[model samples]
Target: MNDFKSLKPISVYSTKQAVDDGYLIQVDQKISQEAGIRYPVYLTRAVWDKYVEVPEGMEGHQDQSGRLWDVLFMFAFFGRKETSSHLLFKLRVHLPNTDNWEHNEKVAERSNRLLREVTLKALVTAQDFDDPSPAIFIMKPFED
Candidate 1:
């Protein structure tokens, strides 16, 4: 059984800094304090830019052997909600534990597939995103 241990609520919003500086992933403040990690953690360039956005001049964008077509691909894949309840969970679980993200293409591909499957299932089971006791759990008290 593919038992997901817990879910992490993710809020992806646009900020001038994010657009200019690159993608940012900020774990909820309270959760970070509890987890003993930094708050408003900025995604490392190596981690965040593993995939680049497709330029306009480019004829088409394809998932290369060792590249992703930017994080927007992820948003599109996950149904583009303002609040994604288990995004961090899906990312942490699906992403392979490799120092080099590109080293294991097969593993990365598999992880992506699994994350999608689990996220979809959770969304379906939850039915309403605003339900107090949604099937997918939030990682922080602030989120409630």
Candidate 2:
């Protein structure tokens, strides 16, 4: 077995930086061409179990691709485990449609709650891997 203790902790690379590096255009383009509204979310396999879990309400109802994850699972899991693999998650998010202040406020409130409720570590992927390797964890906002 690989010595889990010896592998380097993953690194966190911002999505903006990835775009600036010109390494994410192909995936971004594919996202745009296939689904107009869905954005991308990613996480490595080493940390996947931490951030995702089946809630009681949606036990067996969720389809494989459409399953729901604990909102803070990623943050909580990665904060504890250390590994060298760079796993990527191609998930999507659907923000509220209406621009009403109250709705937006609620959204911001929830985001803050998650941030406050969970402590996120500065996690990132290793750089020596080949092109198109998975990142540690990142969620790109929906682009119209």
Candidate 3:
């Protein structure tokens, strides 16, 4: 085998750096704990803005905390069925119907809000390659 130890990485991005740079938002400890997650959990910023952030004009109907809770709870619920470090789960959420379906009568019949299913990927791993502390990261299906 090639000498892997001789190779040096040109750049490195740790989980802590991602959190500090706002690329990853840490889920509240209390919420994760209540959701039966014993490890620290984080949601990629893209995931947060897309699903967890309540859209404009939806202030009273939904809040960030509740949205986040749904995500964590659903992950926990599905995670219990598997023992893998990586998990793929689907969460059903209500979001403003911004799709243009005027041509499709079937879709147009839906109300202003639509219940949508979104796929999220969760990885349970160490805080960093060198750190053994367990942690979790939830992100969109394609995100790293």
Candidate 4:
């Protein structure tokens, strides 16, 4: 058998460090609890900037809390159907015209906004290398 115990990591990145470094944004515990998520939840900076944060022109149309709720709610709904450590779920977001055309072009003519469906990945794992408490980390599908 391989001697795994002899191997040593070059460096370690903890969840708490990630949050402090701005790489991970911790979701409000209360909001997550309201969505039926029992554990702590976090979002990658990319996910936060793209999906959760409302664009400058979309101030009246959407808010951060509502967008965050949509993400958590959808995850909770899909999470109940599967028994896996990782989950890929869909989120429909109303995006403002910010010159990012990679998303769906389906639009609501009245508002001139594009409704795009994005897939995000959620990972359930220990809070840190030494901490076994469960936590959920949300990020773009391609993110590590």
Candidate 4 lDDT tens digits, 1-144: 999999999999988899999999999899999999999999999989988999788899889999999999999999989799999988788886667855423344545457777788999999889899999998888889
Give the per-residue lDDT of model 2 (tens digit) for 59-108: 46543233223333343344345454332222222322334222112232
Cα lDDT tens digits for candidate 1, 42-66: 3334443333322233324433321
Lowest lDDT 10-mer window, candidate 1?
115-124
Tens-digit lDDT string for candidate 3 (1-144): 899999988988988898999999998898899999999999999889877998777889999889899999999999999899999988776666787322111232245346666778999888886788989999887788
Order by lDDT, highest first: 4, 3, 2, 1
Output the lDDT of residue 99, model 2.
40
Which model is ahead, 1 or 3, in terms of TM-score? 3
Candidates 3 and 4, the one with greater TM-score: 4
Full-model lDDT for every candidate:
0.32, 0.34, 0.83, 0.87
**TM-score for each candidate, following the candidate numbering:** 0.24, 0.23, 0.85, 0.88
The residue pairs in collision within model 4 are: none
Highest TM-score among the candidates is held by which one?
Answer: 4
Which candidate do you rate higher for lDDT, 1 or 3? 3
Off by over 4 Å in 3: 1-3, 100-113
Flag the better candidate by lDDT, 1 or 4.
Answer: 4
The regions of model 4 sitting more than 4 angstroms off are 1-3, 103-113
